[model samples]
Target: MCFDAIDMRVFDELRKLEMFFKEETRRGCSIIDLYELVQHAGNILPRLYLLCTVGSVYIKSKEAPAKDVLKDLVEMCRGIQHPVRGLFLRSYLSQVSRDKLPDIGSEYEGDADTVMDAVEFVLQNFTEMNKLWVRMQHQGPAREKEKREKGRSELRDLVGKNLHVLSQIEGVDLDMYKDTVLPRVLEQVVNCKDELAQFYLMDCIIQVFPDEYHLQTLEVLLGACPQLQPSVDIKTVLSRLMERLSNYAASSAEVLPEFLQVEAFSKLNNVIGKVIEAQVDMPIFGAVTLYSSLLTFTLHVHPDRLDYADQVLGACVKKLSSKGKLEDSRATKQIVALLSAPLEKYNDVVTALKLSNYHHVMEYLDNETNKIMATVIIQSIMKNNTRISTADKVEALFELITGLIKDLDGNHEEVDEDDFKEEQNSVARLIQMLHNDDPVEMYKIICTVRRQFMTGGPKRLPFTIPPLVFSSLKLVRRLQGQDEGQDENPFGDESLTTPKKIFQLLNQTIEVLSTVPAPELALQLYLQCAEAANDSDLEPVAYEFFTQAYILYEEEVSDSKAQVTALHLIIGTLRRMHVFGVENRDTLTHKATGYSAKLLKKPDQCRAVYSCAHLFWVDDQDNMKDGERVLICLKRALRIANAAQQMSNATRGILFLREGEPQVTAAAIQSLIELINTEMQSDSSTPDPAADAFFASTLRYIQFQKQKGGAIGERVYVLMFLGKRNVENLSAYWFTTKSFTTNLMV
Candidate 1:
């Protein structure tokens, strides 16, 4: 009959059988009555199910013959010839007899035939189920192949259940399990030669059996791997087995040591080694994936077994080496993924692996492969262990690091530009892991890392080296005992415990960064060190680092915006140097004006020189004592300001005027007037020729703009303040620019 019609009739008969069993049990019927009723059934399906139900009842009786009943049940299940019907019938028999079967323990002194018959019965049922499952694939029409495959997939559990029963059977010792049971079960798996059957049944065996049994017969199970169908994913199978073994070691760690003393791990390694060598047709990715699984298992079982990890890595290396010129295929990616897995506590695993392979594994792969492996190695070091205290561990770790950054080979003529970015990122992560309590040791490690970046590649150094320097500076600051919660004193504490060493490292780091071409970064690093030094009362060191910043600004950098930024930075840095005595103060102030006069833009020069004029005089402390020096700076600023205004007028007559040039010129004029007003507010008593001449040049410039019909209202106020301070000295200038005063009052 077709399966659809049989399914309906079977369920109807099943419902009727369920009702009949309940009635008969309520009437206290004997086991013999049910058995006789089962024997008299008319069809094949109902008869098998009824026989199983009766056998279960008979086994429940104290005086029933379990061996004979089990024997009768197994024989009756074979009566159904329809593949689906026979498979379901065997499924019913296995399920019903699960808890009802006799316990044939080791003390079974009864007839040995009984135990053998029961074993034979289960083996017989398993064998029939396999035949039925395999045969169902061919029973349907050829066009329904997909449909047949789906149905078979759903029925796979019925085939695997017989194995679970055999495993649960009472008196099956290691010898019987190895000699009789395993061989018979594997015969069905191998003899079927179906991919789905092989994969599913192998998985079931790995999961259903005890770890001790698998350990005892590890060789046989792994040897059976070769007999699997060619299309099956043997990697997945081996991975599952390895996972089971690992979990066994984890849970039963205390007592299972005896079984796994030295024998289990060696056997496992040997088995995987043979598998890797024997699977000549296996893809490199599959073999590497299996090795990765084994690596995890080895670490779990015996983490101290470093040699086994090497052996596994060696197998991967050999496989990767055999493949010629790996493309960017899935196989290559899988190999990289396997290499990236954390076999030990983070970077230590990577460090050990790299050390073991020396340069062979790293150089054997493509650039992308090496890049990925290097990234994962550095990341693992960052994430795994933070207890990097000793010199040996740090040395080994940084040796691997140096190789990752630069090449072991001295050839970089045709380097891949893409990998350098990933390497740069890896360097960032490497630095993050160096926050050790021992700053001196950390400083040494950072210097090594810094030197690697310096010599790693010249092209990426500008973009990469600054972050390492900054991280080093942060380490220095931390070592010098600065706190975020406290008020920021640019002169860090003079009584710092480690000031000498801190200044030494900070100075060395900044000096090295000065050689790189990143001007803005260099400026910031030097400023940071200078501020830190000044805070610590190391005046000479502070002045030296600050001078290094000026050197970069003057000689190395050419961007006008950067130069302007540096000028402003110098002024801000010098404003805090009020603690310097007279000679040192004069030296820094002189350098400040020198940098100001060296600005490339006229507007930037005018603004910066006027800004630096404050350093020469102390208003609150000395009552405009150096006002004559301030006036001389303003005189130079006015010349630059007038020159800048003339340049703007020149652009205005041509076709070269930019969008915001006039507004910038007007703002510079306003800034110059504000500087004069500041001097008038502070030095109302100093009689200096330079101040009078500078104010008169400014008044004529405002009059020139007023003659061109431009508004000079803010500049006019500077005239009013200067006139209020010295009306007799500026009467002629006020009349020369009379319209500015008129426009201001109006």
Candidate 2:
């Protein structure tokens, strides 16, 4: 019968009997006659149980020497050879006699009794119970062996309880535990040759003892580990012990000296190695888990010793190297945890980078796992706000996370698009975190990032390269600030440290990104760099950037809307540029107007052409303005707007439509009025005939719209009214607002 199915009431009856013995003893019953019951009872199991209960009370009563009573009862209980009955009977004896042992201050400690006697009693009982428990495994038929093992496992606590009792004894100090208690218990655990018992009792030894005792007696406790049955989970046993010791070390700062005094880490390190060597059949997962636990212990106990942490990683690397790459999910998961533990502890990836074998251990993980680990490494950097400041450090960081940066070994598995993008985007964000206080060094960092991200293929270039471009531009601004009053280069490297040279580098990087066919982003970056150059008064550099943008707009920007937007940006950027001489300014402005005129949609072309009128007229600087060119741009815009209106009317087959007035017409009217105002304000006493003709044609168009007398005419009248208020010397013009209003009334 299983131990669980046995009549629990039997234990109740035993409790009743135990109470009876206690009452009888208190009432001064015959203690000698009570001891005689052992020899006279029918069943040996019942008789031994009764004798132990009575012996407990008899010892407590102080009628006889407690040592003699304990010794007689222990030897007498050995008669019942049945495993189940023997284990329960011994468990009963242990229970009833727990407080009655002849330890130091106990009632039975007088005369020849001592703590040793108590130790002897518990160890002897522990040995017998372990033997009986191990024997139960072999008693059943081979087919029922598993069943008997299960039964034996349930009964293990009954056996382990003795060690608990041993640990609870106030008299058993570190000396006694090291000398007698630990060794005797390990002897039975080893000699029993049962996997279940060895596993359980070794764990019991670790748990039941004080950490100080474990720390002091680590060698003795760890020495018995290798002697256990081969199938025993020695790794789990050792891991638990190390975990406990680590916690103990972490519990008090004062206790660490003792750990070092005992060479705790060294002893654990050696024993784990020894255990791995002895347990040759252990799986790689188990070995790695053992190293992981040891790492935790080291981090807790010897957190300052990085070499020790590295040494643990090195050991893991060696073990993994011998086993080749770990394909097992559990092993790889453990390896990731192993690598991440230090990151979490220090909350710094830079510190993790200092460990030599940190990345070496990662080499054994598969690609997907490597990506996961790489992501974790990046997260550590971001979470800790760690700055990877040097070029070499950036290079090292990229190397560590190469799996996320690019495809390795040409593995073509289809990655989820969003997931891949997110991973690469994290790499991009990490790029921004790469900073150095030195401008020259910061330049080198950007170069290093570019070199690394260039290999990320076209898919990653869009995400990764823009940060480099911006970083390079940022470096330029810094160098310019440093060069404020100095003629000589602040950095000795003139070729590399100069703002112009860095712009060249940015041009090259953005050029590469453009080849990724990401023209829009490329164009945006180019314009940004151009603006920065203009701010720095590097006119030639600014011209080159604008040139690159124009080339992209002509060659790559195919969408009509994109072209319109690009042209507006080009015109707006050129309008703000002050460093450009007339030649470069006009050359770029001509290209901008030409591109605007060539847009796919007429409305887009008309609006872009009108917007380009600003490029020809510079309000902030004098020499860059060309009134004639501005008049020409306004005329060209008016013509395009009229063409676009004609096309709209033709397409819709509607004449003089009041609703849905084209935006281009209003834009042209606005630009024309501004240009006429500017011409009137200029110091030219005699206006050019072309400007006069342009102004006359605009007035004629307004009169034609006013004749229609609808929304278009009202909008035209409003435009003329606002223009009359702003234009100076309005009497100089042939067309006046009053005359137009008079014509409207008539």
Candidate 3:
């Protein structure tokens, strides 16, 4: 290590030197006066230190002798033979001269020879520093290896400063970098044969040079990989270089064609190829790691180039398969992850790559062990294909899906369903984008997906078919307005230019999925399709699907709970039907209400019938000012409620009476009180004949309820208690009106 634990006495001396120079420079001492002070200082090390300090003052003053002062200081630095002291003295020299050193092409600074001398000066200091750094490791006790390494880490930047200064040179073009700079730097890296030095120096080289210079001299840079110490990680160096090149591709994408050119990947491949072959006994994992990093870079730079990625991955798959190096599970896992990296990073480009090279790579990875990688590849491919929204791409998507499922053990049957759910979603997204404004194209893509499902066999269809159907239905609703009862014309409207074709595709999906084993799935999909059809105003199609659901419920569906749900779905669909004329809607409403009445459980029948009763009476829309049918529905609902109540099923009966009982009893008493009060208060000299008759009818009903004397009697008494004062006046008025009518009749 260049740095050591400084004795207190030595620290005090260095501190005094630092302070004296600081004070002297602040006092505006002439550079000549400072320079002569170095000459007069007796000892060699102190003289060199004072010379370097005064040299900085000279350079800052812009004096002519600053160069002379720097040159003389470098010459005098050789006097310190002790490694630790010499390294620190050189570090001090590099720091002081860093800014003042002549940069290339600077008219005020020195010429090329003078600049080279400065670089050489820093390089010579670095070489000696490294030698000293390595020699310090053995000087201490063998047990001190841990402690020695700690000290060496602190002082590593001292040696690295030379490389930093070299990179900082201005106007050093490709020729200079390739001819003069690189050879000299590589000489040091090669001669050291030390892992730490080689790794650190190589990393500095990768970072400090311009990417174009690396591009021009990629061979030289990569050629040094094989010469590195065995412990050196060549991947780090290669990875940094590749990153620089990829950024070059990004920043220069508009102007330069070099990075995007096909030959770029080949060049990268060549460099990595040499790196692998150079080391005869390189661990297969190590070689795989390099190629993996290179593949990622290839994708990043040429993301639009399918062939380049294919070529790179083809080599990787070949190497892994031919060598049989994927022995352990961990290594195989790593390789799988590495090969999957390009898909994760460049998802948008995967579809194009799939069109060209994905299948070739899949052919090699076509086994059960590589199922995860295959899945990852297919998922990325499908995602991009969907985003592009071209119908022609649908066939390729299914092909990839088929391949992925085939790779799964027993065609994905043995795998957990969760694993295939994401792929299914991707297919759904494809269906979503598959529809553009063209309905015929939409039909073609949907039919293609349906056929693929049929070809894939029936076992997985129930799980996978719903998304396709759902996506199709969603496509329809989005094209047309989602509301079912709207008056907007969907057939010729520009918003949904082809509503008929969307309807046809939906029907086609339903017809295809009807034969699957999962009847519950069929029921759910049919219900969805019917509602979507209603929303689009395809009422006849909606009725057709509704009928299909009823058939499923009656025949295939055995679960009582499922049957209840299906019945509710039928009623709900029927209720949304406003486009059908009065006669048609009334007929459908009657059918739904009848189905609700026929439910097995008495409570379900009560609830379903009561809910269906609302469909017969639409407020303000029914022109016939008659409550005859409403009364009929009320009577049937009352009967069902009575049946449920007689069964002594507390939970079941409460479901009906939650609203029905209070409404029925409240209406009977409230109507009588309201009619009697209104007819008596009007002193119109002539009584309305209709009000007379209505008053008679309500009084008769309440009188009947009062006579029954049970729960009904209690409700009637409660109603009468609230209107008792009004009831007395109403009874007197009713008797008088009745007597007056009788006299008139006589």
Candidate 4:
């Protein structure tokens, strides 16, 4: 058993003896005999202990003054001088005489026996107990110091209980706690010159007292923090005190005025500053933890004072500035938490961004930790759905998260591909959330985002740029809508405010992204911008967008399949565009057809050329319908298909064309039927059960016409018969001759 447990058992027996004496007194027996036992006791320890027990009952009997009895008992018990025994003996006296202390309105209260006597009793016992506790450390041999310290730690609560008793006294109001209670406690705690005692007792003082008492005497309590042994964790001690007061201030709104009245925050801030300054060897983790606690307190007590929060962050930054980059994990983790506190408090990253030193603090984190913090910041912005409404704010927000946006200096580690992508994706999502109601200002925001994302290098461009592109397009539409009926342009600068200018900016951004060689995404964004331009009736701008897309296709899109996809997208975009004049339209269409015919594979060329046939035949718009040109394009597609079949026969040794051959053949047949109906105006087209049968009969008709030679028949014969050897299975094709003939004739 520990010494305290054994002492408790001994005290239990002493308790029985006192109860026996009380019963005798009730029966009118002479309790005076207890004093005789005190004098005649074999050991001074027991003698003084017996005197204290009997003195308690004597005071209750009112035979002598309570103050006199308590004073004599406390004075007489000092004779033992053995640290452990004396501490427990005093502990026994305090425990037994707790209720009988002559305090206000107590049963033992009278003229000399007042609350002062009670306060004196507890404070004196506390002072003596702390003395004995500190003395325990020096009594043992030097080598056994750790063992003695362990024993002392077990008995610490005995000394701390005295403070607890002082707190429990009803008469110890704020004035008493301030003037007498706290000062006396702090005096002993500082004078102990022992690290363990100073740490434990300081924490005891903060915890055992009410927060209001601490606040009222903030200076005195914080004044003693730096006077302790340098090894003490003053940060943890101060943190606890601040946490208590913060909670106290948060308990109700009515208490906040009192907090401000006493300048609690300033006092605490000053003291923490002094403590950090005094403890020159304090670890960065300890320093940051201290600031984090202060920040939490500031957020609670002074929720509206953003300057206070910023001051705390700025202080943290100053502390970290001299330490270089924080390489220690524990310190970095603490810094991350410190930086995140305001983000969580305001629940808006923009509010955190308002603090000038927020990003300054983040600069101390290593690369990986920096990215994690950046991710957290982004998640907060997204979670709150806060719209970054100004270009400056957007710029600041991106600057704060620059770690996630780009590679930091000296970061040589190979980034995990998936993790990097996810972080960039989060930044991308954040981009979508940035908006401004003013179109001009919104344009500035896009420009700001573009400038920021441009530094992310090629890898991040694919993820970060598209959102800005889309956002720019959205702003374009808004500006176009606002420009409808106003005499003056709703947008400000002619260079920047017009929808065309925004498209111009988008084109430039996509051009940068194209250098990343992300042709597919670049192409798609270009097309979208083009379509938006078309909608705005900005014909020149729309044509420029298409021209950029085609340029990217020819230069950047190299793989055969990608070329096929790019060419088709171009054709689709061009087919829908009505803004292009005849010259521009023909130029772009010719480029599309030229690139299609130059594909790496003949089959790709064949499909691309046939798809391009739609560009020349815009049925919906009356401006660009050249049926003869359409016939020439289909005839070119058939020729490409025929060449592809011949190549396949020579190289792969296959009988029929590849996957695209059937579509080519079907397109040619439909175009031929259209041409015949347009000239001859015949309605003999009917659905046939077999496509091969209809195809053979058409060839026979063309062949018979070839013998009797007409210009139309010659053209149709050449278009149909060019790829005749490539048709292995007409039934296998997705399109059938019957459906094509029937639909075309109608």
Candidate 5:
């Protein structure tokens, strides 16, 4: 380690100190070893440290080899072959070469201070040392000798230079090895005694390294100011520096990597935590700006940190929702508009809430409900396939609905069902909008999510209000202008786009749910391991979900229908769940052996469940496809519904299940069948959904009959056939002939 010009000046000044140490040593070894140590340390100190560290800065290039100046060391080097001599010899050689040594003992700790004092003493030796230090700096360090000295300009230059280099190296596999460079920079940034050194090194680091490096640095920053850790003034200064770092990265996003941008967001969270630690309520604006910049950086990074990013953004949505709720119309509008836009664009909201001042976002961003809607949309997106877990998405949605129900405490008249129904439709559209990419497990998740809304409520009969709550029957009324609800139907007018948030949230949630590996893991483990188990020896955990759906139909037919409609959900979910593996064929068996008898019984249940599991098939013609599939499911549901109603004990659960599936085909079929039966003046034990399902299935059967040239009265049941058509709704004939041709005389 050779000295730079300034370092050499320090040494030259130390040479002058040679006279002082020599002059003082002969005076009487006043401080004992201090005098002897000083005598030897003059050369040893710089040789070990300043030379080892700052010395590297003076090198013109990395290619240079060591320039050994001492000839007398040759004999000592040769004699180092001796064991004891080698130990002292190696230490002496290292001490002489770089003048820097590790902390070998308490003596080393005591002497390091002597090195700094030595450095200071040399600085005081000549006014020239000051000039030399300035010369070494591109522009002089900040002139505060008593405290932190900074050189923002030089630091900025280093950042720009490396930042450029990193950009150029974006995806390049430059063989440039930097494994040690970051740690070196870390120490330099953390431990720079000189304020100027500290500031410049950090500035250089933030600028030069890629965004990933910044994120890496932030993880270390978590260690910066631990809650109960002992720290020094350096720690204090470093913490302040961190306050500015995210903002600095935020300044020019091109230098920020997605990972760094994400970490900057996390940093905002950390900052919030810090504020809590400090017990500071109502943080300042610069802090807000810093947090906002992190958001700005994230939008630039795109989908990379979206999951963690959503956590931060979600806090704001909650805030804006509150503001919207308090009837702060402006806040409601702003929050809604912000939420309505693509989340990738909302920097302000992101920043404002990153620190967790959720109350403000709620109060200031938008109406609480609207904001909640936005949160649901966004969080739903995050909780969607790509962002989170099925169970989590389910839990999140359930939590969301529960929260809304808790908030809607006012006593409105019975007419307000429109409002409740409208909310339900919004939820319905969100649920129904599930695409092929959506996981089948999501059905169970959705069921589980809205299970609370399916029944239980404080105002209504246990859970009855939930069914009414999600039912869109009243909402369709409101859409026709029959009632003035707080919100409008999102799907009524083609001219009006779906709330961007609603759709995006759906998209995102699907995206997140798609990423959940655990369910997939469970699936994989079940699929692979269950194949090896004997049906009689298997435990329910081995593949319970796989077999659960089958038990419904079999049990419904045999007469133990505890719930009428629940079997439909189990079946629907099974159909959807089987999709991702529709092409895979495996031996139907338990996933594990040596299970409880309760789990292994009903061996046929597994085959029954899987047989209908592949029912909900999603294809390009999504609407038509869903309708067709749903129609079929309705028929299947009719059997279950009929079984439940007939069993007498099944009505309770069927009632619960009915509200959950507002669009159940069996329900619609039953509606049509009841109308038909009234016209026919027929008496029956009760409305049979299985019969309704048969009635609905015959729509296609009638079409098939027509294709085969059969007459109206030539089918299986003449009374069930359409003999004449009547267009009851005046608006119907103008739109389509189907309703006009099929509405009467069955």
Candidate 6:
């Protein structure tokens, strides 16, 4: 069928003839005969040489001699069967490595580098071989079947035989399996159940891969678990996922989730109380995401929802106050922080309260039940007492004050919307049962308070604690010591509504008036002192009361503009009883001829000077000429206007309106009108381009004419645009003066 086969058959017949010859010689075949027999065996010799190399290593460890022998076999196979057998031998030798051949010495022909080069050569050759064989397999219809069968058989032999041999090279690795062989095998097994070779591949992966790559290699090899393996199940998947989770958790960043906090029970909120109350079961990733979501809600949710806020904060407080292992540690710190957060961000709380009209929450507070009540009272007092409006803010503070006291008196129920309202009913009835002067009842009422004083501060109890209640009791003790007077005990008299209790109550209030900044404290104290006065009591102390009232009046004048204006108006009205009327203003007028002149030198400063303007009196008259008034008084003012004093735009403008009206002083009015027209025409002087200001003022003046078209009224208004034009004018145009103007200008 082939030349080599024919040669082999002829050679076999010759071998029988040669055997007869060898039998006669009674010895093995000579070297020449053996050489000739192996000459055509070059194509097959590479396989023999490789086997010998491996055998050498197995027999002698790394010290075996294999290189020189393999090189000599390579040369001996060269040109043995034209290019066919020679090329095959050379290709095979390329894969035979000396380093893997027992590390024998220089005597070993090839080294590890030789093995590497051989791998490259053989891999490329295999590619070429595949191309050639595949071409034969599909060459044509006539030869395709025979060619493919032969090609496949040859390929199988080449792969199975040489793969393990190449694997023995000292540095040769299994890339052929990974990049080539295994991929093909994997594709084949996608639908195939014959998994023995696949198992072999996986087992080799375990042995051949490094520890770092072993698990990952198994993962890749498993692909998507085509079907669950008997050994590997969902639990196995879960186990790996858990290990991955642990690896992720080793990071110490704040990326932990809210669900992880040991005490966190729910969501965070803008409310100081609720923010301190959230809880979580166990730590996880994404705390930043949850925290930011909470922040977003806080920023956007309406702050004025007090009822909603109370519900949320109340729930939070209840949750945190639940008994727990963390009660002594995180709970205490969190509570302190919550209390401080309100004070730190009190502006937002104030704004929210104002928006919701929930100021009553701050007003009627009591420290007896709630720990935060004192701060609330302080802030409320500060906010309300500093205000200056007709609004009745003091009502809230009063309700808080006396309401707490009323609730403390036994039989009171609702506690007036202050702290712990439900329990007040029980306390109120118990309080009524006690003897009015019983000290034991007071002690019971005081039990809920933690401390009476601020830390590191004054020894006296805070005024917010309703110190009047304590001071009243204390004053009673002092009065009992004052003299052994025969008067029935003032504070403890058992008669219904005892006079002593009333006196002590007044005295208690007097002490508080001395301390807390109640908005009505001064007025209430004044009333008290007035009632308590006796005929012979030092009159000067009443003077002191007057002095205090005077001081309060001054403070209000400076602190509140509306009150100052009202006070000035009241003083003016009172002065109308004595001095200020039209009669007085007439007497101070200046005399002049041709035009009886009247002038207010600077009416803008006149408000300050008019503190005494009411000292002059005048009676109303229908007819008046005030020209002489300005002529005398403004003689000096005119000199000052020309020299020292620079009149304000308002003052100058008013002067032009009064004196410069042609009906008053025609020459002066004509001169100003000429000057105004001159300025309007000048372009180089950068005459104001606010030409509309002129037109607007003109239109208005025309509207205000006395005759409904009076030329004089138009002139009066037109004079106002002097020194200012259009939008640039910031001066007031109208004045509510007592006098109309000079001459017949009215």
The CA lDDT of each predicted structure is 0.66, 0.78, 0.62, 0.78, 0.34, 0.34
TM agreement with the true structure for every prediction: 0.67, 0.86, 0.62, 0.84, 0.26, 0.22
Is 3 or 6 the stronger prediction by lDDT? Answer: 3
TM-score of 1: 0.67
- Candidate 5 regions off by >4 Å? 1-204, 210-396, 401-425, 431-746
Give the alpha carbon lDDT tens digit for every residue of 1-746 in model 1: 55446645765676576566756866888667878878888877777788887677666563456777787788777788798888878877877676755557532214533556567778888898989898988897999989999889988888888888888877777898888888888888888998888899889989888887887788778878877776778889889888888888878668467446646667766766666666677777677678778877777786776676677777767777778666646666766655554434334643464336433445555655665666666766666754455445555555545556665556455555675666777766566665566766766666566666667655556555667766666765675534222223333444433554555555665566667656777777787777766665556667777778878877877888887787778777776654455776678788889888888877667667766655755434453236457656766766776576456421000000011224324656556556555554453334445455545655675576679886644321222222233333334433544223443221
RMSD of each: 11.9, 9.4, 12.2, 7.9, 25.7, 27.4
Q: Where's the lowest-lDDT run of ten residues in candidate 2? A: 650-659
Per-residue lDDT, model 3, residue 221, is 75
What is candidate 6's local distance difference test score?
0.34
Question: What tens digits encode model 3's per-residue C-alpha lDDT throughout 1-746?
Answer: 13444433454575577567768867887667777877788787777777777776676666664456666777778788775677788777887787777666643265323666656666676777777766666767999987877777677777888888877877466797888788878888888887777888898888877788777777777777778876777767887788788778768666247564435667778877776767656677777677767877777776776677677767777666666535556455556656566667666532444644454444444355455555565566556663534456766655545654333435544656776565455444445545555555665666677777666456556655776787667667666653344234332233433555555555556556666666677877877777777667776666666667767767787777777777776766565555556665666777777877778886667557655654654443454222455455555755675565446422111111111343545555465466446434545323444434444544565466557753422211111111224334334432542112221110
Which pairs clash in the backbone of model 2?
none
Question: Any runs in candidate 2 off by more than 4 Å, and if so which?
Answer: 1-8, 25-28, 481-493, 650-746
Pick by TM-score: 2 or 5, better one: 2
- Looking at model 1, report the run of 10 residues with the lowest lDDT sum: 650-659
Q: Model 4 clash pairs?
A: none
Model 4 lDDT, full chain set:
0.78
Can you give the lDDT of residue 205 in candidate 4?
87
Worst 10 residues of 3 by lDDT: 714-723
